[model samples]
Target chain A: MRVVVPFAAETPKTRLESVLTPAERSAFARAMLADVLRAVVEAGHEPTVVSTAPLDLAGLELPGEVAASASVTADDRPLTEAVNARLPGGDAETTTDEPAPVAVVMADLALATPDALERLLTSTADVAVAPGRGSGTNALVVRHPEFRVDYHGTSYLDHRETAREIGATLETVDSFRLATDVDEPADLVEVIVHGRESNRAPACLREFGFALDERDGRVDIVRNEDCAAE
Target chain B: MRVVVPFAAETPKTRLESVLTPAERSAFARAMLADVLRAVVEAGHEPTVVSTAPLDLAGLELPGEVAASASVTADDRPLTEAVNARLPGGDAETTTDEPAPVAVVMADLALATPDALERLLTSTADVAVAPGRGSGTNALVVRHPEFRVDYHGTSYLDHRETAREIGATLETVDSFRLATDVDEPADLVEVIVHGRESNRAPACLREFGFALDERDGRVDIVRNEDCAAE
Candidate 1:
């Protein structure tokens, strides 16, 4: 199976702007993307980074083993369109004698592990979905060529409906790593606290001097001024 | 309107047993209960504690102002039944020439504030619900006599159906404080981090030496053994 990691490279993690500068946000976004790509590549998939713009793969510093085989494609369309276009029958390059399955993994899943991705890829169902916090479709493994994605409001529910309409056996994968995507300020706390064992994201957070601190009765990310000033 | 705080005093916060002893859990549960009660009383309502067993009011150490008017009652029924029985028409004592409205508040909302409770109490709808994280009905205000509660799975959804069935106007009160209920071991992080501005819960968590720490690539609550050892 081929894995597609859709990344909004141009204006990624807009919600984190309150804490991170635009450059910092981009760096953090790339770090999370690299972590996700590492997991997908470790799961024995030829992962493709579907970017909104041309990504500087050299600057990303992905693992050498995975980086060697990884590919990048520029797709300015909306996420659903980009993902649908990348699926087997939609793209000329992906069409084969027998259609291979495709998995659309989100770029912000900093906690995703190789085991989690392998479980999703190996599922027998025509459609396998991992639901994120709230109503998001975090990751999807689509075996059916006609099953297009809708990343609109409550898209997980919509995916289930879409799967049923196309007569695809839908499998739901409830994974803690997949469910927790770094979105809001509160989510960054999750990354700082839960990502110690991870390579890329935790190192990025530490480099930025991001630490969890309580302020005004809320768990917030605080940066050491001296370290950040450097 | 009368406010009922239904506390599962018998086996309260069984989920916290991984981190807290049974006595510690009970103390923590009572601390959260006091916080909710304090908010209810500050909202200018007579609050009652509906316990699974007869509560020792003197031992609870509630705020003096709230404790003066607060009452306690024993009811071993399920949460739905206990809350429904406390509503206007369900209880004979609560039935009057002009029925007063009822608000059922959960005891585990460590972040609840007086202003939050006041907003819920003053809502014009016949049934006002405050939805918690996941599928919980955090708090509910019932102005219509026929409006009862069902604290089953996805209870906020069930409450909406219950309101519709009874021909009551349903209002959803979206309060962050009301939504954050301390349940799992992870939830204690929320309480320790966000309850700083609050009174009882924060103090209790601190007294118990609860602090957020990272271990094994997961965010977890760690207690200072020296402080807890005391």
Candidate 2:
């Protein structure tokens, strides 16, 4: 299977601005992309990173196949547009040369593992989706040629309706790791709390001196006192 | 909101028999129950554990209200039938004194956090469901007077159609914490990998000398040789 990870490198994760600076956010975004790419390759699939800007993947340890191949495509278009154009039945897609199956995964799924990615990529459903915490499509596999994603409001629901309209079967992949995308400041807490042993997203953030303070029944992301402020 | 957690204490988690003895499975189930109960109480709600048999919660440290109140109800019946009998629209339920809103949560949600429970219980939607990994309803809140549960095959889909049939609003609490339920040996890896720092399910399993050997990209639950076999 071929997977396309849509990453917004420029001004990415704006919701995390309160906890992470612009530079930190960009670096964190790259780290998350690395995690997603590794998971895709480890799940036995080829991945191409569709970024809003040219990604500086320096110092980030990614899968060799992804880094060496022309896997990272820089497109400054919106997430939905860039992703749809790469789909099998989208604009300029030739019927004879179209890819039979393709998957679109968000770059911010910090908790995703190879097992979770395997479930999504190998699902026999016409449209397999891993929905976000809200009405967002975090990761999805498109076997049906007519099913294209829309990143607008309530996109998860829209994807279901669109699949139905196109007479495609929709299977919801209820995976915790794939469903939880790190988009907000509070989401950082989730990654720290539930991240796997070797998950690099949290390791990268921790290297940036990030910590979560859970006290008095409230959770907050804080900087480590030992590490001096930048 | 009043929340009911359906627990099968007699022969719990039969799918895990290959990995755990019956006694260990029951103890692990109770540990998971304790986690869910604490999450519900900390989320600021009342919970009652509806068990198939009287639970032996001797070693498990549960929430004060859950441990103190006459909250544990023993009903030896099928899970679907037992739960439907408690709903407001079920038989012998008073139309005048019906609890306007009620929530049903599975006791095996080892990853459920207080924040996840708060999202399900505090939803203004007429019906809120936290679907499990498959077509199972892991947790749900019911506000519609005519709505009832059916734990048959594809219960999650059944609940959605039931809500629509009764002219009630349905909202999916797309929560990862509430979705991952500890069931099989393979699921043990999930608990150990993604379990919170204070989550007791993995801790309880660890106490049983359970360990995951993730060698050569394959995850296997094993016993620590240092610890004597049970």
- Per-residue alpha-carbon lDDT of candidate 2 for residues A1-230, written as tens digits (9 for 90 to 100): 87888878778888887777788887788878787787787777877888788876545666567566427769988888898987878763546764678889998988788888887887899999987744468899998877888887557767989999999999877667788788777678767655666777788778878776645424466787565335
DockQ of each: 0.02, 0.07
Top-TM-score candidate index: 2
In terms of lDDT, the poorest run of 10 residues in model 1 chain B is: B211-220
The CAPRI category of model 2 is incorrect
All candidates: TM-score of chain A? 0.93, 0.91
lDDT tens readout by residue for model 1, A1-230: 78899999999998887777888889899999988888888888888999999998878888898798688989899888898887757763445677788899999998787877776788999999887644468898988878888886557767989999989999876454676688776777657644537568878888888776655433456788665632
**Model 2 over residues B1-230: C-alpha lDDT tens digits?**
67889998888998898777788787788888888887787787777888898865545666557566327778888888887877767653555774668889999998787877887888888889887754468899888878888876557767989999999999876567787788778678667655666878989878888776645433467877555335
Q: How would you encode candidate 1's per-residue C-alpha lDDT over B63-158 as one tens digit per residue?
A: 789899799999988888888887878863445667778888889988787777887889989989877644368888888888877676556666
Model 2 steric clash total: 0
Tell me the alpha-carbon RMSD of every candidate. Answer: 19.2, 20.2
- Per-residue lDDT of A154 in model 1: 54
What candidate 2 gets wrong by more than 4 Å, as runs, is A56-59, A63-66, A92-95, A225-229, B1-177, B180-230
